[model samples]
Target: MKQLPPEYYALLEELQAVDFVLVELTLYLDTHPHDYDAIQQYNQFAQQRGLLKKQIESKFGPLQQYGNSYSGYPWNWDDAPWPWQV
Candidate 1:
């Protein structure tokens, strides 16, 4: 892997945290569908997640592969096994 700025990892952690919250909210909404406050929070967090993703991709590269991300260069989608892969 190429060297990445500290901010990359920081932003990535932020993204992960937000995604976690989204997942929790989704689960909560599944059980408490009438909670308007939770729904609003979920939508707001979802938008924030989108912005963070775009910022990361714009500065570094795609957070995912397949059709979920776009790249101008062939290597933007890492050819190597992902860090999460063993």
Candidate 2:
């Protein structure tokens, strides 16, 4: 199995944190859109998450894809050596 670089692992963790923040903020905003502070914070994390996603995909692979073969890069998410393997 192949091992991911330290940066990739760190980025993965950061992405997870960003995702959690996004989900929580999304749920909160669903009924409280007037919370400008929350909205701004959500947007900030969302943007960071987007950029991290691209960075991950560029180095590792796409976690999720959009449309039919019309995005992302060439990654080996199908085979062995999952994230925890390293």
Instruction: Choose the strongest candidate by TM-score.
Output: 1
In order of appearance, the predictions have TM-scores of 0.86, 0.75
Candidate 1 residues 6-71, lDDT tens each?
887788888889999999999999999999999999999999999998998888777677777767
Give the per-residue lDDT digits (tens) of candidate 2, residues 1-86. 56567998898899899999999999999999899999999989989988887787677765664532223344445644444564
Candidate 2 off by > 4 Å: 66-86
Where does model 1 exceed 4 Å of error? 79-86
Residue pair clashes in candidate 1? none
- Residue 67 lDDT in model 1? 74
Clashes of each: 0, 0
- C-alpha RMSD by candidate, in order: 2.4, 3.1
Q: Tell me the TM-score of model 1.
A: 0.86
Model 1 deviation from the true structure expressed as Cα RMSD, one decimal place: 2.4
